[model samples]
Target: MKTGSLIAMLFPAFVMYAQPGKLVWEENFNSNKIDTSVWNFETGTGVNGDWGTGQLDRATDRKQNVAIKKGVKGADSSCLVITTRAEEFMDRKYTSGRINTKGKASWGPGHKIVARVYARDVKSMGQGFAFWMLPDEKPVGQKHMMWPQGGEIDIMEYVGSIPFHNLGSVHYAWSYENNEWQSWNHAHQGFYYSFKDQEVPNPSEPGYGNYPPAKNDTIAGSWGFHDYGINWYQDRIEFFVDSTVYHIHYLNDGATLNFAKDGENEDAIEEINGKRTGVSEYSNHFPEWHPYEHNMYIILSAGVGGSKNTYGGPISDAAKFPCSVFVDWVRVYEL
Candidate 1:
């Protein structure tokens, strides 16, 4: 083995103990102008659809939509704010801000990504804010797939429609066909936590406004600003809210793969002429490949529009306009 590799394994403490949770990169947004070197504005109604979920807002690069606000109350210094306004623009009723670190910076295993956000205005229907990641747009030395297949890591997703609920999720291809490879046969597995309370109420509950005749709940941010983060490991990922881990997703759970391909599928096996039928029986579904072992870029956005059942559900008639989500800072640390 290489000397460096052996040292790393033998004295893990020597390498990581010196600077536990070392901050590798950060964005305080203290400058007058956004550092274009690290962030790029993503504007438009998405390339081929309503930005994947039929959101009503169209992203714009206008300063009003995304800008650095100074002398912010409660925050330490300037904050990066993404505002969603209820105005007609580009055939959309609302305009918002979306920015990302597609090629500038990306992180993978052994790293923790976190952001401090003040989302009081993110309350009210039709408004949403998120801190998420996607596979590098131009991954080096490997082929990358598109959405659903490419995979996504949602560190934090808060919607005004969900009231006290917040989300953390990862999307991956569960099963697919060789012929129809570019399909949406994906599995979305994650958990939800509450900003006000530790426990999240069920949607079926009588008082929950998540159902028909949506609730008029307009609760705002949790405290002034809260931290949302994700600790990425080679075999698992942990989601955190306010520095506490709330959920974890394991890459392998000891379940055998449905087909001969090692550990790809988790379905029950069948017999075909005394041999395991594996994935052949299902024409539409095939074993899935582990898709989170690659580099992924960060994305922070605010979206508008949705139904009562979904995040950022239908905009309530009483919902106010010009909602904004403030981000105090973002940092990536070595684990």
Candidate 2:
């Protein structure tokens, strides 16, 4: 019964970048509107953040929160905006937007995807801006297998509280030593990689967070435009910021969750692995699951939260309404 309200829009078009390989897909966001032909909005409070972290506000299609407009520099370029607010709506203190290319765009092994994005704001950057992918609905016994088994590819994720850092991660399910179906995410659902100097908590804890505490200015698209690129290989996926490799997730030979053959959703135990109460640590083989070898589609979203217990919670209250994550453009090339 709950639905979203669309606001009046004032946006422009975008230009395509020159890159190698065939230009299979691209979103200029120029149509002065969100071309629904290539994107679908996800409306509601997210499961993990809303159910567990109590972090993000509900997602709506309101133009105030999601719209296309002038680019970061000016109107010469166009961009998509996902804004977060401090206003109350539908039992939530804030509101935002999330969109995905579900039935429209999807990719498998041997592909190159890049999203020119601008996250972080001068006054409001503590929330979260994510560019990731979900599975392309693999048929199971009686339904579509999702999450852990299907796997998650997080191309770029940044939290304002951690300023100057960007995270790359993947999610899958595994069978533990106790033989329980447990879901898991690599590198703390973020790998929590920092491109700048930041203080560490509980340094004694192994793999607690980034080490050496170095400082730099690669602040994950705070200003200008930054490319979050992903090179999807058959056995591994590499994440890059410009030409630098920040994270690489080596995958197994087969599917991570191949429990049911087709038609049915759950396997033997009806359990999922790697469900985090909050951000945690990650490694090569921890929860004991394999990498997912399947197809997935893209998602672009922004939400408020990222201090502590929530998903990017406990951030500076200086971030008020109308905070936004801008997407200059998104392109996928055949490799």
Candidate 3:
């Protein structure tokens, strides 16, 4: 996504109100093992489809490339090093780990969500590390096929080659075609975008891929951990990085309504889906279609070789056997 900067005037105001304060859930990762109390491993080389067609294998042994390392801590206490191995694909080997709270720590219907995580040495794959939420139930078809309809909330997704920049989005099915592959359908979708000033690139305009790095001073990874957080409130969702607010979307607000209305333009609707379904039918697939009211589970995974490998191409074999994504901790709080 292209990046640009805009300055606007701001006024500060404050008011005080009384509210309850308490911890809802958390995982400090201090123990030598993954906290079973907060997470359960979703083991397996995932099946082919949008949910993730890549092979997601569980790591049996702990290595620097794909293990839980001790002695590493963010700003607070000790940290866990989640590594990736380059050993599965014939041409390339990219290894990573994935953990979720499908049944162990699912959050239902109402709750505020917040997590603090630090990632570095993220291998240059398109599908980098993700701290997101998904519905705990399996959709109608195969277990893996439950995307769009099953519900997905991507709080943070980073494409390795381009660090410091990220994406936050939500996906769900709009309709179906006779309950079959050829008949399956999805309509409107939207995502909130933001980036550090330096990392934005201009579109090629014609027909080429522009690879310009961010225009500002490069942000060093050695600068240490940055706080990535989200406040999921009933009326709106806000995202913050390093304590600075980056994006905000009001639930059922005018901005969302306009996006939905524009999506129904004949050209926009045709581009999204064709003749089999009408535009009105297509528009119903969004969370705005319903209320953003449902429980969700947290999922963290680093994909290696497979179709989802977004780091340009698979890691060269010579570079295999020694890559890792360190995590300080993952915590959730209700506000």
Candidate 4:
């Protein structure tokens, strides 16, 4: 039997994320070491140059950047910690850690992915962490669908600049005006949550009034170990925080897959017959051609910001260095 399969069968759960289905695989990070059989480190600026975000950090396999810590305060004694520092490395101004489960494990429809992460409130600035996924397989002997086309699922994202705010989004293909592809032409549905207030926010209109408040407790904890997850299906995806459903995106929302152009329906809502209905252009629906139907692998990373367009904005001298992201555990379930 494969090592990953054996580990799946033998390892038991430490804490449940409360998603539906049988636990099939998990990484508790309790062994005082990362399981290389299930995870791969991604070093340097990344494949798409700057990890597709023009971030300042150069990922490294050095212990200073990625390592497992034992006897962590809030976690079950051990956790995988990825730290980002302001120190220079290999000509890059910053260094951080990034890892993925590409060939070892991949899950498709009818599965739920969850992870327990703790990015402490250290007053750190100009950096962020993400628990996201991407397609595991490449197209066979055909044109490649880059990024937003192949599909991307951001289960959880935390930007230091936007403290206590969590974001979940899906990116997919969109119609282009011509044969040439444009980045803004990508279709996306993003959901936001304010961990401080336990409220959901409008993703499109950032300044809109807050949505209803959730009954759940604030995400703040002694060391802040919270579960972030997603229930993925063939036709929809559900976002979860501490097992509570925060947002749901359906694939058959009676919306068109492609938009004629960007900014046509920036509002994502329209009124008809005295009632407002979601504009098809901005609906959170997935088309059949989308790569969400295929299998995707998990990515856990802590990125440092440098330039104006970098994630979490540019780093300043006021920003603290050696910021850390502690991952208590990661698990997958079969729905």
CA lDDT, every prediction?
0.67, 0.59, 0.46, 0.66
Better of 2 and 3 by TM-score: 2
Error of 4 at 33 (Å): 2.3
Query: Model 4's lDDT to the true fold?
Result: 0.66
Error of 1 at 324 (Å): 0.6
Q: Which candidate gets the maximum lDDT versus the true structure?
A: 1
| Whole-model lDDT, model 2 | 0.59
lDDT score at residue 42, model 4, on the 0-100 scale: 89
- The candidate, 2 or 3, that scores higher on lDDT is 2
Superposition TM-score, candidate 1 onto the true structure: 0.77
**Model 1 lDDT per residue over 259-308, tens place:** 24354433322332232211111111233434567789999999888645
Give candidate 3 misplaced runs (Cα > 4 Å).
1-21, 49-67, 88-92, 108-110, 137-145, 176-184, 187-195, 198-223, 249-291, 305-321
User: Which tens-of-lDDT digit does each residue in 1-335 have in candidate 2?
Assistant: 10100110011011112235888888888888898989999888776657245565788998988899874573237889898887889888888899999988888766888898877452333477889888776644435554455567878876655455566767665432332334452123334443432211122112212221222335334644677878775545656666544454445321123322232222111111211111221222423333345678999988776536444665464555577778888988875
lDDT of 3 by residue, 1-335 (tens): 10110111011111111121456787767776777676665544454422353434333333443345666555466665656665563333344567788777766433546555555554344335667887765434544434455556667665444444655545555543322343254432323223433211122011111222333324522235655556654444545555444344333322232234343422111111111111111223343323245567888766544343332233333333344556676766655
Q: Which ten residues in a row have the lowest lDDT in candidate 1?
A: 275-284
The candidate with the higher TM-score, 2 or 4, is 4
Quote the lDDT for 111 in model 1.
89
